[model samples]
Target: MPEIRNILFVMYDQLRHDYMSCAGHPTMRTPNFDRLAAKGVRFTQAYVQSPVCGASRMSYYTGRYVGSHGAAWNGYPLKVGEATMGDHLRKLGMDSWLLGKTHMTPDTEGMARLGLTRDSVIGARVAECGFDLWVREDGLNPEGPDGFYYATPSPYNEYLKSLGYPGENPWHDNANAGVDEDGSVASGWLMKNARKGANVKEEHSETPWLTDRCLDFLASPQAAERPWLAHLSYIKPHWPYIAPEPYASMYGPQDVVPANRTEAEREDPQPVYGAFMNNLIGKAFSRDEVRSEVVPAYMGLIAQCDDQFGRLLDHLESTGRMEDTMIVLTADHGDYMGDHWMGEKDLFHDCSVRVPLIIYDPRQSAGSTRGTTCDALVESIDLTATFIEAAGGEVPEHVVEGRSLMPFLRGDTPAEWRDVAISEYDYSCSVMAGKLGVAPKDAVLFMIFDGRWKMMHAEGGFRPMLFDTLNDPKELDDRGDDPACAETRARLMERLSAWSRRVSQRTTISSDQIIARRGKARSKGVYLGVYDENDLTPELLVPITGAAKGDFR
Candidate 1:
């Protein structure tokens, strides 16, 4: 059994847990993802700490909850002092490199306050959410009223231009938006444009391009190290949801699954949930015409993503590195796709929060778990601990809040594990919060799911939301306000409260350090700290008793 020498952490943006055929998707077939699952463990109950991009990725990178990391939304900066997976792996002589998106917003304010310059190596790494960038691209280069979404030129756009897709922003034309016969941009953001294929060559698409970039990195001399973590983050199966060539027409509206919504859900919805349902984006998804036009494109993007995964997998096998590297396929978060009448992922619904987690660990110890499914509750942040442990590094419990899945990968169930999966969202940074008249701090929501029951707690004096997922598998029913479910709601709330009060901030020091310093004050001649002479050594007590004052002096 060779030790797991490297990590290929592949993440797709807005990929739902059930979209893969292996996860029981009735229409979408992701054979490549299924292959990975067959070769390793597929987690049935994996969730992210937050359902949005930046905050969720930060939680995965830092192994901390959103509250602990203090990054509540996309573009929110992860604080400077928090330790990330890169920081942990580096301590064990492994380098963590980023090949694509991290969705990380640099802590510019923290950097300025601490006098950290981005030009410095430490500063650069800090700015990248603790990764050494090997071609960093957040992938979305959408032009808006304020210029591009990122307000900077994209390297991908430059690459597209080099490939003869001439324009200042080919990212919008060839990569994202489709081009009409009149050469006008068919913006993918529009539902009607989803019916058309992207104008880019299939090979030049973002998914394939990012895969090539990863392959190039692997072939590079610098990546010859036996141990490294390469985060191959792809921006796809996300919005601007057009696919290229064959993928565009691969799935039709006929394959689109019916949305998990009902008039019953709309009636007497919780205040926060109601606000999201009425959000502009949510309203768009609520229309049947929009869903009919957009869902096929969404499916096409995922199919393309799966095809790219196959390419990467084939490359690894061809290079004979497949047996040595651990491959983890997951997503930052899941898209709502009109589920619960939502367009994006800003809620705690399963479609929005749960994500597919397939881990292919080639170690001999993982043989028993191969092709097996683990139903244990897990979080996206758990990958940090799993990676550290797989690399033969100690799991820093104080710094990382997630439990390692190494035991499950080794075909062993943990003696005890978390019964519930938690997710959070802070909508204050979103337009929906303003429309709802809720303050930033009060606009936050937390979800706790114990498999059977899912509970949502919103701040700002909003009502709680409860779902008996065992009965309403689609989460169509809200039992939070039901008088019959009062006891169930209270119990779940207690669990959430307990989880929130955990010792999350004692990250700099371990419990062993505190224990080691238990009686140090008395040993340092602080006599008041000791209740009796036995509490201190005789030599120390003699000096403290003034019996050997001259010697002590």
Candidate 2:
């Protein structure tokens, strides 16, 4: 077995797979991200369970689908009792720690119902999505007329105060918003001001601040003896669309590639897709001006993220931890960046659901696959199973719906692998649902992509979307209404129906334990059935035959 000691699992928010140089972006280069890919295996087609933040991260942390975990959207609580990657790693004497955002809302109601107090260890772990938080910052500290996004104080805000940014909400002014000549706050939330840079210093920015915290935790003297799974989750490259000084101006509109949309998409859009296109954010991204301003800022934030990766890699190498540690660099989900007539990650487009996944395992077993690329269909939840397997533990398949990628990392491919990639979106409470006149439960969408064909099934009596990726790779054309594609759509729908019928969440106990219990029940004269006399042991047969006849009379 490969001797892996630690896990450096890194996640970037709202990073599209195609944005990285390693993944074939035309202009935006990410050398540090490419460096890790060259030293490891880069997955060409890794997708998240959901396109949004909270639901996607919950799927990743728990190795379960959004429907399974029941945390369907942002601000939705993950119901207590779902086992997470941290919970599984603990069984093998490993500690899982979080250095940054999880986007988790504690299941306060579930805890209350179960009488799990906040002071209790089990309660705290359940509330934290099963990881010990080293420093928790969801990074969206937007302050509005109502209040800050999160009502509580932020450590990032506290750090800004220490740096002489005196304000009630310096996070908005110094970090997320820019200052005008008149000393007015140009909030980054405004799409018009996306071209502007942030007021904070690059070193004090969210990305670098979170990276510094990780470095400090790794360098601490009182580190735990058990192997550690440090989740260095960054909230950058997601929003505010602003970077500090040098990174802010690193790229211009000229550096941005053209948007991946066409007039054809708007000609006769799907009812559900059209409703989303009319959304405020989507309409803004469709305009040439908004794309010109925001794409560069988006690239700048990504550039800063890449630079931080370089710093982290240098530290690990200098400390001689590179060889013993397994580093996984991936994003929670991708951003639209004006693709498919969308602005954010709410649809099933590759720009929204597909994410970059790079894994660097230092074991000699991984040598053969170095600098390689795997085209296998992968899910974000697979990382949970991979982490458990790498730490010398068996994957609880009853709980985890994803397969491990260890075989691929070790230069081997499993004889059988999933041919389709699945992604789901719950838009019941979204603005799109209101525009489409659909109930919340009827606004759900599930995508089934079988490498070449992509089919989307929407609830609320919406027409299913069919795209022949082999022909219309850009997904500019929807063939759901095309009679010629009926068979293809039917086949994919059947596959999706079969997938949904899987027996998920049935593994609270091991198969061995279930079998042992069967034997124990049989020993207590509880026989389910017997087809023949040979089916029963002599002791069990004796009573039925004649041994107890006189006693019964």
Candidate 3:
């Protein structure tokens, strides 16, 4: 195979597959991503191996499952020595340039020490990756001058403020107004915007600049000759639930409001797991003052991302770089977006795990397969293999789990492709699932989605919940107890069991050991959070003083 010249990867922070036009989303309009899908292979059923941001990203970058790498959750570091895609690509003589957030913590000092006020992505232990350049932040969200909906000012926070919002805003808290089928808003104040269309292009906002920087890097002479890799990670559609005018009103709250819960759904046994229900949103918005306008603003935010993405694509095409470049557009994971009464992405349901995965192979096809959606199961881990293979490099022998999607991207699905995809979480293992019956014990919840059959096996609370996704796409009903679905459940369980064993072998950290090592770190006053494997949010954690790093562990 000939060497591929350039690799362009665009990963959104928290994007849901159902929100993309190419993924059967009739209401959302993402022309650029949609266009890419038209010409390339679209994995209709793509899921993150790990549900959260850091863990899922680790899986993709390392070509290993999250369980294999010890960075099980956010705020945690990957084991001291792990080979990343950047490392492997560099070995093949590729000049890797990371444009935006990589989510990896730079050093033990954390964000504050690296000239970062918030969680910016920095690859501290990425020495082996051999990236030529990394324009990274510690966390995924970029702080603008305007600050987030309810945040204070800082280097990153000021970026949000410059966009024209109060200096202290926390849009991430909860502003999801529950939308009814008839288009009436019931819960959030996302619509509480003083100025809309006029300020969308505010200079301080980071999205525009992130794109600009990426373009600048792409245009550089070095990129053309070295076969560079650039990951344009955008922070839009992630929070504040506010959008500039016109777009804020582009889709009326009534126009874009998707399916809601029914009375029967309210009574769902798996209510805790359902998406787009009042029970979920109610948690975020009990105050009536700011409830009704949240959805509209949130919709507008997504439109902004789509628009920026289009601009980036246009620039690539205009520069004559679109044809030779291999573009992969997807997200780290999905967001609940007021679904099932939830606001962020820290769950195991499709709302948090299934994301849009579009691979555009400019060398092989372009606009050749418009509207073609492949239903094959694909996980984020495959990306490492796909990129290596696409760049005419060898897939690392250490990463044995991921299957390259190149064959499928070329419209060839080998007979051995797996039919099911699995995801997991280990944060609340002891509380959610019983401690694995072993020393230094931990619990885990494993999920398997195979076509219409979806099984969630927990260690404790719920032994296992099964859903026929086709019959109940919303997953309102649990068929685990129904005798008729026994065979289906059994088949899924077998897969789950096999996956469980595989994960066991791949387990990177023993809960006891992490606590011990982290305990010393925490005593020194470093803010720490434990992200669950399935859910990125810290389940059980302690905040150490942001005091000196040496003061703590």
Model 3 lDDT per residue over 260-322, tens place: 334453465453343223343445533233334555555566667777778878888898887
Candidate 2, residue 288: the lDDT equals 84
lDDT of 2 by residue, 293-383 (tens): 8999999999999999999999999988998899999999888888877898888988988899999999999999999999999999999
Which residue segments of model 1 deviate by more than 4 Å?
A: 529-537, 545-553
Q: Give the TM-score of candidate 3.
A: 0.74
lDDT score, candidate 3: 0.63
User: If scored against the real structure, what TM-score would every candidate get?
Assistant: 0.96, 0.96, 0.74
Candidate 2 at 499: error in angstroms?
0.6
TM-score, cand. 1 vs. native: 0.96
Please give the distance, in angstroms, between residue 433's alpha carbon in candidate 3 and its true position after superposition: 9.6
Better of 1 and 3 by lDDT: 1
lDDT of each: 0.89, 0.89, 0.63
Q: What is candidate 1's lDDT per residue for 178-262, written digit by digit as tens?
A: 8777989888877788878898889999998998999899998768854799999998988887888888899887999998899
